[model samples]
Target: MSADLGWWGVPLAILAGTLRGSAPFLFVSLGECLTEKSGKINLGLEGSLLMGAMSAYAISYLTGSPWTGVIVAGIAGMALGGIHGWLAQQPRVNDVAVGIAMIIFGSGLAFFLGKPFIQPVAPQLPSIAFGSWSSSPQLESALRVSPLFILGVLIAPLMQWFFRSTRWGLLVRAVGDSPDAARAMGISIFKVRLLSIMVGSALAGVGGAFLSLYYPGSWTERISSGQGLMAVALVIFARWNPMQCLYASLLFGGAQAIGPALQSVGVDAYYYLFNASPYILTLLIMIITCSPKRTLTGVPGALGQTQE
Candidate 1:
């Protein structure tokens, strides 16, 4: 797969990597988007990601069903999210502090529980072979896409529409923008925020499943690699828009794919540097988006504010 394509392999590999790599980002960013849209930030999603990866791998190995693993992963994430939401709602408790604690707790729990399943082989999720029409094996392999990625793509637009046209979406927006106003309008701010966090966490868990069951395809202590943490920045870069999240995810995915893609074409001198591209890109994006002079459009008004 590495030697056959010469320079042409770079673009193809990037395309393939984008499809494969973006799913996790897409799911995580979307999850974070929902949470933030409801005026909450889930810094603990990294923990949820690791927990999901461990849970999915263990379940898949035991049940021989990848889909089951995905479900369990989502549940695990929801549980963590629920905990974060509940704790953050306490009077005088800071959500950011709660989020940080969840990160530690979730990741520690996952690492402890995952120790037993580290060596087990698990069933992998299936991919759609879009490259079947190609005569070249490399091309064929490159075009194989994950069903989860497709689902994320479809959900992005649906989320956009939901936010724009649905009454429930309006309620969520109202809560995020002004809890006092939402309360005045008879909305349960607590319930709305709690549900949003759980659903968002569930999506993050599915992203973790994608990592263990599809791409890297294994249970490991380091499976998440900060993708969950980076997702916060991604959501900001996307301006809380689901469709923009998709594009940003693809960009991040392509950046991630560059290192291995270059190595495949025999460019090894700068392999480590290439692999650092995603992190570097992340830093650049945060710097650009977090500029003090620029007002961030679409940021939830109540985001990061202390609740009375």
Candidate 2:
């Protein structure tokens, strides 16, 4: 029994790590879930997320209020999403290419704006007290999970329920599966997609704010750490389901924490590979879940059409 209990500890430790590590991925996954469900892909999520991180820190540092930064970050994200949506509505613009371009622009923008913020310690987010539950340092450390993690978990179920049970969700589904048919049914497909993109961007902005206010409050080029790109792939892995994204993001998080664990144990050889784990997993999940046939059949029919 003692041995069995000791073995059980490993999973519990991983679970804690998963909760801590997956919080960011969860935000990105949730945002992507909203975007994809509306039948449009917002690849610029990387740029939006980074810009949010930079913007949040800068705003909070100046104002001394973390909440203010969070709000501004959301607005910035909405702006990015709106721009992407607006451009996508144009006849000649390619969404994929536009996303890549935004990534470059966002990167430059963050660096340019974050120059002054690199040294200052920005405002910190308030945390839930997991510390009260235990005395052992290990246990206490494990308990220090982010509130955002909890929120992300809660969001998954709520989003799932909303989409399956609400009128607005039905409209979103209508837009994704068949815009023409939805139009025939009196739903405005363009309006649904536009709304979804804005919502998705706002969520993605929140995800970026999570980085600045929570985990690592310092601004750097690598803060977002390619999380945006991988999250784009996570949408496919989650199969258009927000609830599934919660689980999938946690799985990716667990995988990500492995290398750090190794480094702690004095094994440094696998660090780079561990750093790459999330993207690798994201890519694999995409390949496994994406079916060319099914995408054509199930995806929003008006995906590439001009929204005029």
Candidate 3:
């Protein structure tokens, strides 16, 4: 019932966009989930993400390997996460304050280092063309799925299992739910929390790499576009479950695709307004789904506490 594409095609386009766009959300939220589950919070992941994007792009451009860039991005994120973890171990240091400082430092460092990379071209992550099986060229183009997305999907279940069955997962849960119990078991709180934060930061870095090296496929000052911060809210919305994070990320991705989907169907009025629809939708969903009662059920008990 349309010119370029039929009415049914619009939804399909949105579906494609959702899958493609959800990769960053999935990875970021998973990282946030991991961090929160370990009784620590890192608000500075936004900075880590930005820094990762910058480093990924710069490295890819310099080394001619996007995968290398992704690896470097993970390392960059881990470096920032390690710093946050180490500072949190200091006497009288607040995790939130340290996280904020890391954000400022990482962002400033990234901006300074990323100046020359703004205009340079970098290698992009490759995609698998699932649309090859389709008869439609549009479908084929839309079906070009990134391997990173598939990896994220796989990671969700793995994370869920990790928390449910693995010894490390039990330790993280113990540290999160009851620091005293973890200590009683002779577990080092500093080591567990620090390791969790580092892993979370590394995941976030890979998420950032997905942004610059895959989706928009470029380096810039604002490549992250606050995806890391949004992921914090998403983690809250998911109640800290990794599997829930996968679905929630898809919802967010679909919300983001609404604007572009409308434009593709010749409904481009107030494009900026449409662009902001994803945030609005995500907020509404969070408000609708979040229960005031039992609000803290899934929250880690020891989160944000300064242990003496």
List runs of model 2 lying over 4 Å from the truth. Answer: 1-13, 268-276, 279-308
Per-candidate count of clashing residue pairs (backbone under 3 Å): 0, 1, 0
Better model by lDDT, 1 or 2?
Answer: 1
Model 2: per-residue Cα lDDT over 149-207, one tens digit each: 78878989998998899998888877877777888999876677778887787778878
Q: Identify the superior model by lDDT, candidate 1 or candidate 3.
A: 1
Please report the candidate that would top lDDT against the real structure: 1
Cα-based lDDT for every prediction? 0.90, 0.77, 0.87
| 228-253: candidate 3 lDDT, tens digit per residue | 88887789888899999999899888
lDDT of 3 at 142: 78
TM-score of each: 0.94, 0.87, 0.94
lDDT at residue 163 of model 1 (Cα atoms): 90
How far is 113's C-alpha from truth in model 3 (Å)? 1.4
**lDDT of prediction 1:** 0.90
